[model samples]
Target: MSHQLSDISHQTSDTRYQPSGVRNDAAPIGVFDSGYGGLTVLKELVKVLPQYDYLYLGDNGRAPYGNRSFETVYEYTLQCVQWFFEQGCSLVILACNTASAKALRSIQQNDLPRIAPDKRVLGVIRPTTEVIGEYSENGEIGILATKGTVNSGSYPIEIHKFFPEARVYQEACPMWVPIVENNEIDTPGADFFIKKNLHALFHKGPKVDAVLLACTHYPLLKDKIQEHLPIDVKLVSQGELVANSLADYLRRHPEMEQRCSKNGRQQFFTTDATEDFDNHGTLFFGAPVSSTHIVL
Candidate 1:
């Protein structure tokens, strides 16, 4: 089941699939997202740890996992994790908040031991939650995310584990994702939705001094979000927090660090059209990207 760099060349009539020119025997860290949102996290990872090779897979064809059932998110995420293992990845990061909220624990606790004991999978939620309390002076935190992530209650649960004194408030921005994905962040429609959600979140927790953009895609709307936020409130995004936590994790576990390949190589794959992914992905990734199409 091992895949080589050359395998990326195999393509259908409608799409072009290109793999990295580097060799694949070395283990690269895998980054999985339900769609292009994960690119923001990957962008930070490369900035902080550019030497490590990375494989990013976006399940674009079956994306918008935000509202899916927990069982369905887990199933889709596990399948993508297996694909990363087949491609010789020793570690995978669930960069999507929805996937992380719904699937990460199940995969780490229930599936990894049975399928690949030596391999590891991490998520964005824990890292963000670990230090979220420090950003709030009032001990009141707000979470803005998709319906699935807010419904999962993962942030409140995990944040309590580390910062028991913190009170967490959540608001599901159902229209935010669609606004970002449609490249409408600069429009009046985007402003309306962003303001609506922010108002609702603050209404639930008026004393909230810090707000976490619990969804990866929300970072793209940071500017607009900040414009509507109270002047003193802090806006916390997961990209830098997750990146720093990952660096610390690798430092603490040299065995896992040694398992990661460091050749500065990166590859992108999508379950939908490469052209569309590349155009939208570049916006999120902060760099021009060319992606290959994958079926699963």
Candidate 2:
């Protein structure tokens, strides 16, 4: 079911996804997100697999996929995945919960087989849930995510698959993404939404010993979230969890691992202004970043 190299329409010769270059196994791993948040995941990935090369794509111009409809998210995500395929990525990780919740399945089940079966696309939910139940001593965990993810019911479904006894309570923080993307996480303006969202989560269920930051963007509000929660509640961030899970996945699938190039190089791409991506990406990624401009 592997898509032939001829399948992708890499329109421009100057585009990074241009099909002219040799398509080989020693290609870069692709990391995608609706915006800069996924840079956090890429940061951890580089830490764990510094030897491998990575090409990250941030769809910032049309971001906040959390508010988009399922079909739109799926379509947009599929476009990015195809772009990665054109760039010769052997694997892709959707670092967006909204995209993962609404789009990953359709891409994996429907599109992959027809378009690029040989390439693998993984999501954050399963990896996060695989260990989430362990933190729920009371069998009840809280989920803080975007509206799309919360509406998708992905957390409860994935969590129950691993811990049937565990209860999942979700709160959709619609305003949080805007606040973080605006680089206002530390501002007083963010407190209202942060407190409001946490309050809603606590009211949704009994005392939740752990709260999963279901959206990658939420980690920027870690302190605010923690301050709003009980002292003992453990905050689970997906970057580290997903990174570890991916490391294990590569170990288990040697064929895929062997295909990844270990050049210790990293590349960043964005649909928005490259300067803006570098500025905000540096904030989320925890370092300086130089991103290239790309069209979908």
Candidate 3:
């Protein structure tokens, strides 16, 4: 169920240029997600990179990519990324786990350079795993994510590459996002699923010192998850760590960092109508979105 790429270092920049899907000259860093899950990552970005402009696209109409076919997810993600590029975004973030699993590399390899030379397309996976490697005391960690992310085995693979001795256990709470999306965080069923999954992770016998909320949507349920977990263990949210990672990356690559602006713009778009995306996204974004529906 997993495709392993041994030596991803070799997967780095290949000289051969191919046609990129789109191009643009916008000031915003475009962010795409299947739904509101990306807001967690975006919130962190705004906190860390407050002076920079941003453009967010949430694909709410065709959300919950976790249960969809891989090919479908890839195509849908590609469409959004292309749309962002057309909007003049220089960099894009694949903030959804399913998209990162199914489409990130193809965009990086076959699509990005052609679209915009050396332009960046960041993902939530590697930055998260890198943070996990940094904080894991005994090298035992747990990952709570969607079924697609768990199936991808991205956390384990990335962790093992850096910390071979680390023991990683993952639990796919397929219903968690729906519960969170529906604002059922306090519902009995929500608590039941949270308890059930936490117990399952406990039974895995990993002595988990840190738990990574691999899916960005998981941050919406952070309080509930923390309440269910033993206090000794720490919970890592993708948004927080990803924000720090992005700051570091910007420091290292000055060209990619946005120049200081007196007034930065934050643009939002959705493949679905603004009404649909706004209704659901506000909960995660902590504010109403000013999204325009695009033909992606």
Candidate 4:
């Protein structure tokens, strides 16, 4: 049988569902990442919108979506997003760069209407691109992301839309994910990869005034990235920017805002076992995520 938001709402109506940090009236916002990377986005969400409820789904079993075909990534992301909707999520956020590049549009256009009229889906790329244009001093900016994201040219496209004069340079750090997953963020080889990417960007031109960390996992290597940057180059991260954007978006869309519960809390799920998810997720979220597991 297919599940619906009404099913979850009716079950909780009789009982007081206490919202901890976020809005209490609406269902939780669904967040999806290929693996633990989305934790970077989650951390900011909890910090900036603490009053909203959140449901996080990490597709750990079939992660590294950066290498997958567009069709495969789209299908996989759609499945996860649909599952979140069934679990009573009024909004879904694609915290993965790869998914945002490959699947966000198709899901928003086709899947959201089928789930709920008020339902919405968001992605990380546009938010980052939008923010970069506002903050960049010069018309030039740099982006360090996964191979898929760079290949998609999402950053440059969004940047051009906002700042026609902007010059966007992209460099893909394909190995950073594995290093972060292994907790080797500060290892020598990690430094080498970080420096290599930074060099590639700087070599493009001195006009690059800001650098956006296009991958969620890139934040884990922020310090190393900073070390290799020019003193004038500003670093833009998606987590905080995306969180703030959501807050602004909600405020402007009162209908969506009013549906959100001010007393909501964060709930986590993983395609793999909860134990493994908790361990690795803790490393990513910077705190223990004691939540249930749901296999995808």
lDDT of each: 0.88, 0.85, 0.76, 0.81
Misplaced by over 4 Å in model 4 are 1-25
Candidate with better lDDT, 1 vs 2: 1
Give lDDT: candidate 1, residue 89.
Answer: 95
| Candidate number with greatest TM-score | 1
Show the colliding residue pairs in model 2. none
Q: Summarize candidate 4's per-residue lDDT along 55-171 as a digit string, tens digits.
A: 889998888899888999999999998898788777789999999999998888876777665788899988888768776887888889999999988889988987888889999
Residue 118 of model 1: what lDDT?
91
Q: Model 3, residue 84: displacement in angstroms?
A: 1.0
TM-score per prediction, in order, is 0.91, 0.91, 0.87, 0.89
Q: What residue runs in model 3 are displaced by over 4 Å at the alpha carbon?
A: 1-26, 258-262
Mark the 10 consecutive residues where model 3 has the least summed lDDT. Answer: 14-23
Residues 49-98, model 3: lDDT tens digits: 66456788888878879878778888889888878777666678888888
Which 10-residue window in model 4 sums to the lowest lDDT?
Answer: 1-10
- List, residue by residue over 1-296, the lDDT tens digit for candidate 1: 11113233222111111122233355879999999999999989977876677899999999999999999999999999999999989889999999999999999999999999999999999999999999999899999999999999999999999999999999999999999999899999998999899989988999999999999999999999999998999999999999999988987766677677765667899999999998999899987788999887
Candidate 3 colliding pairs: 25-88, 26-88
